[model samples]
Target: MSQTLDAAAVRSWCSLALDALGREREEIDAINVYPVADGDTGTNLYLTVESAAQAVEAVFAAHATGTTEPAPADAVRAMAHGALIGARGNSGTILAQLLRGMAQVLAPPAPGDGDHAARLAPALRRAAELARAAVAHPVEGTILTVASAAADAAEAAGADGRKAGGTRTDGTRTDVAATVRAAYAGARAALDATPDQLAVLGRAGVVDAGGRGLLAVLGALVRALTGEVPAVPPAGHRRPEEPAAPGPGSGPGAERDGGPAFEVIYLLEAGDAAVTRLRERLDALGDSLVVVGGDGLWNVHVHVDDAGAAVEAGVEAGRPYRIRITHFGATAEHPPEQVQRAVVAVVPGEGLAGLCAEAGATTVLARPGEPPASGELVEAIRRAHAREVVLLPNDAALRHTAAAAAEQARTEGVRVALIPTRAAVQGIAALAVHQPDRRFDEDVVAMTTAAGATRYAELAVAERQSWTMAGICQAGDVLGLIEGDVAVIGADLAATAEAVLTRMLAAGGELVTLVLGEDVPDGDALADRLERYVREGHLAVDTVVYRGGRQSVPLLVGVE
Candidate 1:
């Protein structure tokens, strides 16, 4: 008979869940059909669990400092809360709410009589209720089905325990363990039946990925009950490995260092204290800890057996922006033969695409209509055989997707980087300085620095009259965005453009490159106005280049 769960037990369960998630994430991502190509259900659930695990670790650490035993309920609640705030995408939101319900059921009064197993049934039931309420239209074959089945089975098992003259109401019931075990069994059965309920799943010849993801979670919980830790999936199940390290005297592009021995990387918010703390924690874990901090972000690379533990430590120090764990054996020692890099530009016109192609970016997944999906970006990179891919999301709306893609790639052993360039002009500037042979870190720095040096200006008409944008914007009003922020709004396009240009160029610019969108009147006309401004202001100008094309938006100009 199982008794109570300790902090270590909780950690074991969380780790197992994450391992299960890691094993199936890609499969779930590939089979999602209801939402079309926006299939991040697996990724979202994985991130959500990871966030919760970190929270649990923090709770445990805090409890260890005191005399009191770690409260499993409290730690679980913290994890659920973290998942709520860190949740992304539809599936992620639903998963967060489910965990929230679980937390609520597991809260306070401390399950009387130390009957940990009895509480599982009620918690499962609450999770189902919460998950059902989260979705506007709940589907039967997805996560909802699995959770519901588990909850119902737990209730049934509890009833059976009572019928057998076992302790059910005392909360000291050891029979509750049996109930949870039964629940997991029922949940697995329901998972197998998912395809029968949803025709789409049947047609796809696979069970619902979301449903399977929930099963994985339940499986972890069951494993915890059995005092077992889940193992990470073998390398074959993950992303392809990097090439082997080149031998001695291997040519210029030869593999080096026998494939990095192990590539350890993690993400955290950027700060001196955070970096210092992470360095200290990683030092104890392993060697070769390279700490890189930039743009309010930090990436810690360390080789260690405790990858998850290292991530947990980082989360305790600060909120993690992203987290990736990969073994050197899982990836090639050197870069692939064709390290094709693809760039996604969120510009609003055609000229940007041409410029992107000329800059050596073979495939350009333009966000012409709706925001591009992460899968689309992933597919583009895969199609390009991009060993080291650089994503340039020139629109703020698409920035999150790019960042998520980069995080996913890193997890899967792909060398991916994102340059948060907010405009096509900035992307163009960065592309101008890109070097194919440079190391990824160096290339990213060079491109980002180049983008930062350029000033941007654009002219566009408002699409709506809603009380949006702080009442400063109206229909037909010309709007100008400086570095992606709406800085000037007025009735005249040229005046707004001029004001933005003047502000951006105030820091002293040598040349101005104006790439007008299809909506703009004419590139030459705008260039002439800018040239006159430069001559009249006695500003030393080198040259004015004008180009016109269609893009995701209108009017992208870069001044250097």
Candidate 2:
């Protein structure tokens, strides 16, 4: 009747939470009115939880050969770490801290040596407290309020249950189902009352969007522990008779309407002392400031007029990576206009996506095993908002998917051209030659020619003992693939990359491009070494490098 809070339960919680968020994402986005009103709160929370779920799955996969399952501590720690690194926007950042707080209590032994159900109350309380502390100025009517209410309800429910014969003869208290149900009910009530607490929500005739999302998450937790799906609430947390007010950012006194123009977020590796000072600096520089995470890692989020200054503060604090800065409105250089042509590219990582975006291409980020679906590509083409679109499927495996998306867009009255780019490096080459101002056919031909002329290779680790063109390779061997065939196998990343580069350069001519993945240790040094090797061995060849973020492979090589 009672589900124990073990590793399997944690895994199920992550999966269930993700599905719940996915279903409510659009409704939550519609109700987002606070902290900038960009209408992406739901999307941000979904991505954050998706990352956590993936991390938990990875832990289970790692123990596939072992007799014992992954420990609960390992699973929860991974979930918190994943959320911290992948968190986006203000609501998502606070949610990460909440999960981290729960992990603090759950990952270690209980103070009184209590059972798993007995730990739930304290975990919820810690989650609320830590989340409140993470925000620079804690708001009363947001997710923080709902979280605190849930904690209080959980504690109260445990106390009541113990008084009502819930405690066993051995002294174990209430079950997890009771605790989770109480928390979810309390959160739901808090969400409904948010309009009365927050002025903006009151004006908009809707409850707090972040609070509503938190309620959904707690509902999933209820299902995870009790095997009972909570009743779904109305859309946008608005009452049936209440007429909708103006949409966010449409009227006077709108929350964060004329606020800071940019939202900057990044993952920082820094000491606690550095973080303390860093928080003060960021608070002075912006509003909606939240610095979440600890133990030498943090996720820093802020809204600032000066995006560069916010980033500089992180640099002073420590090593900051996966930096994302989003503009809230149109820029001077790119005024709102219906374009004639646009490039839609499927890129492997965030860095490459940013690069392609800067080059005026609409980018769809492709994660390790999660390739973009045809519908997602179609959405990107729609987002491009152009008369003619050039689609680049960066991986060869996405060729048919890209074609389907193109055909779909064609039905929507958009001209589409699909470029057969077998790798990210080839996409980079095609982007280099793209000129939207040129004739549509001419531009397509130019991009196609550039992609075809570029020779591409990648560095990957063999998952198991396998036969290759080069020879037999064992698991953990760095296999250098040239034009999709294995040519060299080495023990080290730099060495294998070098071998791949040498082989590609033997028949090459002018320039070399290297894209380094996040997993590549000392990537800058490796890039420097490879560049030197190329300069010394090849005549009249130029070299360039780019950080590809967390791609599937260690290195991508291209020579033209």
Candidate 3:
């Protein structure tokens, strides 16, 4: 039996929770009769867990090439952060808060935390308290009640352990496993009692949908600790003889009791004071208000009549992006519409950015000497709002980072394919033939083929004296690098570019594209002369030029 909650155990818990939610999503959706009976509690829960699982996977990927394992704190923090950014609905938002609360205590696992079990009781308690505080209107007979009972049971179990000589030599609790087991048992009992605590649940002949989701999560935690999966619990009505009246929140569009018309959510970059004010403003605007995350970044969610006003509030307080608005009433019976495909490319220059944008691809600008993190790529995918996505890293060094981002996006139900485009020109070539209407696999293959067929070269001034493949080059020497290796060294810009172009075409080519940087000397004249040379020396070879405006490199050449 497993006894400690290490990094691996945390990962296991997230994976198990996702699997459990997947198995029970439809059942939970059928019984969502409280706050709003939109029939998506199970799906939201699954999505929230998926995000958490992705975060854990990212943490592990970061350490994949290393000898040491990641600390439990690192894993826990990623899980919480993932949930905050990807939370879907009311229940999902509260679950994010609960994970955040647990992370607060478990992230820095105290000095004397010998066994992982000792930390479970306190984390569960903190999670319960924070989850309660996050909700605008606290209601019992729901997930809140179930979470609270679990905490209470954990504390009671701790007390029982103390009475049974559970104290360590330093007078600390010794039996953390017992406390966790008790908490899981208490949560299950609370879930069964949910029908009695709420009139809506009783009328609908179902348990609280949110409570059932929490029970599944807690049971996953138990399995992760002890290596024994629990039997799936029943949802909704226990007996066929029980009443099955339609939920009170049911109307023509399930907009019963005149609640908000839309659900608005976004990620905001703001200060703590601004967030406090935002909370107050949002609470007044609508019900089911949830603001989660910290340290300059936050995830805001609320149900409101005016979705525009809700997004405007975020803009007034701070910068908000990835704004998603859903009509709660209109889609009561129908699922959401899916976008076919999108491409997210990381480009080095503004010119390339515009080009990619015009080709129906989302572009991320790469600042000089500053690379983007995996989170930024994930955010870009979120902004695309498509079911299928193609990602272009545009740099060889970013292969690992791009892979991690694609993995994270996949967890959130996005189909992401990472194309290894080692240069911006290759990405440009790939985007030239993007077909959103085509099959996913066929489109990906076509893009990949375009990117692979292009042979790329760059012109840059040597930073310092160094020996290269061609010869020894001094600082200020114009260096021509082909396929990441220096192939030609010359004293003049025109001479070096001519030699590089000659060598590239020697391998044979039908088309050549030249990108001139901000500092390129005589840019227009150089491009004209190159085009003339290609036409004269290699018949039927076409040439094109664009103002690259990128730093460090003075010119880029791609031959296909």
Best by lDDT: 2
Each prediction's TM-score versus the true structure = 0.48, 0.80, 0.69
How much is 470 displaced in model 3, in angstroms?
12
Tell me which of candidates 1 and 2 scores higher on TM-score. Answer: 2
**Local accuracy of candidate 2 as per-residue lDDT tens digits, 1-560:** 23767788888888898899878987987888786677778877887887788788889999999999998889889888878876877999999999999899888855464367788989999999999999999989899999999999999998888788755654556667778999999988888888788877776777787888888888888888779999978646455555666565543236556689889998898999999999999999989999999999899999999999999999999988667777777422223576999999999988898899999998888868656656558767866878999999999889998998899799889999999999998999999999988999999999999999999999999999999999999999999998899999999998888888878888866999999999898888999999999999986999999999989998999999
Clashing pairs in 2: none
In order of lDDT, best first, we have: 2, 3, 1
In model 1, state the lDDT of residue 322: 29
Query: How does residue 265 of candidate 1 score in lDDT?
Result: 46
CA-only RMSD, every prediction? 17.8, 5.3, 7.3
lDDT value, residue 536 of candidate 3: 87
Residues 89-126, candidate 3, lDDT per residue (tens digit)? 88888899899988998888567645656777888899
Per-residue lDDT tens digits for candidate 1, residues 1-560, read 12445456667767788888877877776655432223556776776677667667767778787888576667776767656544443455566667777777666555456545667788889888877754544678777888899999999988887788855464466564576578788887887777578655554445666776777787787777765433322211111232244234332212223323333444466577766766777777765454533345544555566667777777776766324444433322232356545554544544656667676774443424434455445645654456787778776667887787778777767788888887667787888888878777888899999888877776677888644342567788878877666778878766776787777777888777777666666657767886687667645865455454645445666788
